[model samples]
Target: MAIKFLFFPFTHMNKSQLKTVLAFFPACHYLSMNRDFKHDPSLQTLFETGKINPIFPLPEPLEKVEQNFGQYLAWARIHKGNKVNLKSLLKDSPYFTDDSDVTAITSQIKGEKSDKEDANADALTKEQSLLQDLLFLKMAHLCDEQNEGIDLALNDLIIGHDTLIASLRGCQSLVSHVKDKKTIARKDLGEMMPGQRIRAWARSLSAMGALEPQGGTPLFITTSEAVFGYLEASCKDLVNALDIHKIKVHENECENKNEWQHLFCTWLMRAVQGDGIRENDMPVVDDRCSLLGQVKLALFSGNGINKIFNCSDKQIPVCLIKLK
Candidate 1:
């Protein structure tokens, strides 16, 4: 089955209508798979014995850390700054008007002076470690909530909630740690330079009728601000064969998920099978592994499945261009 044919109809669907289509997509696709298996004994045997799985192999079980964000509380403890409190560093206040001032605070938090004076400085003394101790105790309480399984639906919600907050904090710590480090260079997308990426993106967009017909006039394409900036900087002065237009975007108003440029590019790459996309693109569930038990528990508890389909309505942004 060609994915283009399957998903092309979605371009016209509204949100609610689209959900209706998706609700039946899996069951319908599975019926096709079953029909194929029944018609061919070998294929049926492969499916029954799990020699070959359809579309997606079950995803490997979630790692312990992936299963619960509470584990990251321990991670925070392990990577915590050497300074136990920022009160003395900030002169016992929290007001910084400049990057330099903030840098000073972070430097003290990181114990740069202590490291210079003695690399093997002792951990913060208990008396000065009040804030750190309290923070850890709070995290420990969160971990206990998950371990105790207070309520299944509520726990599922907590897992997602904790992951988001913990991830944000973890990212903040990481960025601050490397604030003074040299910037890492962005790698090329496979072998394609920025210009090449733009050209290839144009080709796919045209195939999907995402390109605008300007009749020799320039037509602007829209994309997220990030993608626009990337192309502007990296693809400077690149010539185009198609009737050209500059990329346009509204920084604040643009919804990240609805970025048309990115959404179409993702659909093509995931759904279409050819030299351009995956040759074996199909509707399949990844191996559930140990996480199967967790999902079952959620299901039994009236919590919805957290399974990721091979295809979805809101795809991560791919290309940075869209026809305006």
Candidate 2:
């Protein structure tokens, strides 16, 4: 079939959600594979330019951490129910603020023709369930140092929750009347950063359509402290410098699924053709194996197919609906 086209009859993610999705993925975290896990050569300049002071431990290579974080997140977002609405999801939370730019993006996720395109609810539910399983595995890995059985325990506690979205707790003041809780655990508190970044990216993506919106435009704003500040600073710097007007959202790659599917196909094809990939081993083209699972998962969600596609499949039928 030479990969004729991929049909994606699904709602597209809005700009804010899409941008958040982008920002959620780690950039270039190339710490050495040795036990020391040294930073990438480029990171020295980035640290100096950004004046970075990181608080997280450097036990594992950053690529591993990023792989763990980004892949699970990408999968969760793909399989999340109700289209991963950062605006409405965080609207009532005191810790987060909704960006105005996400309005258009939200509208897009719902799709222009509701009668023509409604998402696969049952399939989404199934994906969310699987995401919970992945979450359990990740949580176990994170807590492996504390206890060997954490994964099994986490599986039971995670129960039906997809992400740790519900189990998290922060001490909102009953006595102090504080609007946002300050006593949140370091790990739990860190979750707010991604939420803020998601909206910020959406706003920036929205501005991409505008020819000029004035320089020094705020890329992202949040009350998150210095701990989560490291990643956010880089995110803001990148978006702040970007001219989104230059970016194009292709019609076939029009929806998030189709776009992701197209990208995944390109990646998988390269891996299959190149000696860089292996059957049982992780696929690493030019030493970047972490992204393979994410691409595959994206394709699965785009088409609501539960089965993982074989990397060696030469002509996977990825059809496109009539271009918008």
Candidate 3:
């Protein structure tokens, strides 16, 4: 079997790797465009204004490239005025992959603590989870620095929302613990807003392409959960179809029964790493019944969430496909 890619959470990245990761965005604008950015009118103006004659000499060695990009990213904002396009880049390359490396680094973080780690040490698990969330959220905070940052933050959050939607629907397996969640009609989406985060998310959606109120992106995100009562309403048909009876271990009797939070964290971790989760390594509720397996089953079953909201909207088709 080929080796799995190790997703280094932003916390795991040193300053150099973090900035190098951020640099991918500005590099996108230049690299993907046909015109040489060096002689472009807007780029030249930026270089002159920022007093930075940007160079496109990305190093051949990954290590040197990391260092060079880190340096360039430090000034990318001063020159191009775009916020770090981390959300989309992360969606594309969430984890570091080496075909020869067999270790599952994120899995290891939850697998076993160091010999010195105490069970009570700093609530290490929670802290670790928050670090990932904070890193994704930092895009919002960082964008507050400039109007351009605001737009970037919004784009990041919008794209992040789309990415997660793809993952959930693609990997739909409804755990008993995942509450039945639903997204209302797009027109009705406004009634539930006003909470700071949701409002901000809605605003981002509104601002997506053309600035006109009606011309904005049709998607409006209200809550993060996507189950939408699919599990409770259809568990019987689903259990029989997947032949879940064969492997469905009773969670009530399990020692460390998985919760929504655990499954969620595991899912997000996999998404950030940009990896197809090994069927075996998905969040474990018990030896027989995997949290991810159940979710995927629930998603695939008929009369599911994908059928409900996504049938008409269908903005994000799938998120967890490239299973290696």
Q: What is the C-alpha lDDT of each candidate?
A: 0.29, 0.28, 0.29
Candidate 2 C-alpha error for residue 150, in Å: 24
Superposition error at 286 for model 1 (Å): 44
lDDT of 1 by residue, 267-291 (tens): 3333212223332332222323111
Error at 189, model 1, angstroms: 20
Error of 3 at 185 (Å): 18
lDDT for each residue of candidate 3 in 1-324, tens digit (9 for 90 to 100):
111111111111222222222221111011111113464465465445542222222133223323333443453444454435544443466342321111122222223334334443465553333232232222322332243344445655665665576567774444222323222212211122113222222222222221122322111111112321323343223321111212222232244443533454455345333465554554433456332222222222344423332233232111111000
Off by over 4 Å in 3: 1-201, 204-255, 258-260, 287-324
Among these predicted structures, which one has the highest TM-score?
1
Off by over 4 Å in 2: 1-44, 47-200, 209-297, 300-324
Between prediction 1 and prediction 2, the one with superior TM-score is 1
Error of 1 at 297 (Å): 45
TM-score of 1: 0.19
Greater lDDT among 1 and 2 belongs to: 1
